[model samples]
Target: MKITLIIPTYNAGSLWPNVLDAIKQQTIYPDKLIVIDSGSKDETVPLASDLKNISIFNIDSKDFNHGGTRNLAVAKTLDADVIIFLTQDAILADSDAIKNLVYYFSDPLIAAVCGRQLPHKDAN
Candidate 1:
């Protein structure tokens, strides 16, 4: 099954590096990675370009909305069998996260699945 992982960002400078790293470490790598940046003024574009298996899109609009960027990213990959939406600030707890996500599709009836999110200790 082909899966597309979409990550939407806005001025996500240093945070994107970790997200891409986490994707690389996944036991089951996605078929494609789509990153949509909503007019970032930082180094996010260059950093995204350096990552393997990633397709980056830089939207020029001055108004930034996470949901809109996410929709655009999803539209770019409508052909994929499964879509995985991830935030740039998230880091998978395990390399098997993607593998586990894919396992749900084996049942055939399962249409979608979601992962859990936890606050970083440093956020406190």
Candidate 2:
């Protein structure tokens, strides 16, 4: 199945670089990576812009609605069979992360699958 990844970001700073690194380690690469950035004053846009398979769109920070922005990203990826959402701070524990998550969709009834979220090492 063709899958697309959508990540919503603001001034994500150094967190997003680690997230992208983890993505690169995934056994299965997403067919497309759509980054919806909300007017970050930092380097967030430039950092994700050059990545392979990445498509970026910008919106005013005030215009960024978690639900609405995600809906817009979904609309842009009509070609994908499944959509995966991730936060900029999320990092995969292993290369099998995406592979394992996508496996659940083998059942036609399963419309979506969410990966496990472990607390960050620095999280209190």
Candidate 3:
């Protein structure tokens, strides 16, 4: 199955690199990664650009809309069997995270899957 992963990013802050690194280490890497960046003044665009099989689309920060960006990604990955949307700050817990998630699709009746999130150790 063809899998596409999309992320909407702005500045993404200090944890952005870690998030991208985790994605790179995934056991089941996405066939295509679409990064929609809203005019960031920081290193977001440059860092994402260096990755292979990634398509970066730039937009003015003021024009960003949560639903619209995802719709655009859906259109761009029309041929993909699965499309995964992820926040720029989300880091996968393990290399098999995507593999485990995609495994559910073996059951043809499964329409969607949601990943569980855990609080950071520093969170109150």
- Pairwise TM-score winner, candidates 1 and 3: 3
lDDT of 3 by residue, 5-31 (tens): 999999987878988998989989999
In Å, residue 49's CA in model 1 sits off its true spot by 1.3
Evaluated against the true structure, the overall lDDT of model 3 is: 0.88
lDDT of 2 by residue, 33-80 (tens): 999999899988898987789999999989999899999999999999
Top of the candidates by TM-score? 2
- State in Å the error of residue 86, model 3: 0.8
RMSD in angstroms, all models?
A: 1.7, 1.1, 1.4
CA displacement after TM-score superposition, residue 26 of candidate 3 (Å): 0.7
**Which regions of candidate 2 deviate over 4 angstroms?**
none
Query: 25 in model 3: Cα distance from truth in Å?
Result: 0.6
Question: What's the lDDT for all of these models?
Answer: 0.82, 0.89, 0.88
Evaluate residue 84 in candidate 1 and report its C-alpha lDDT on the 0 to 100 scale.
92
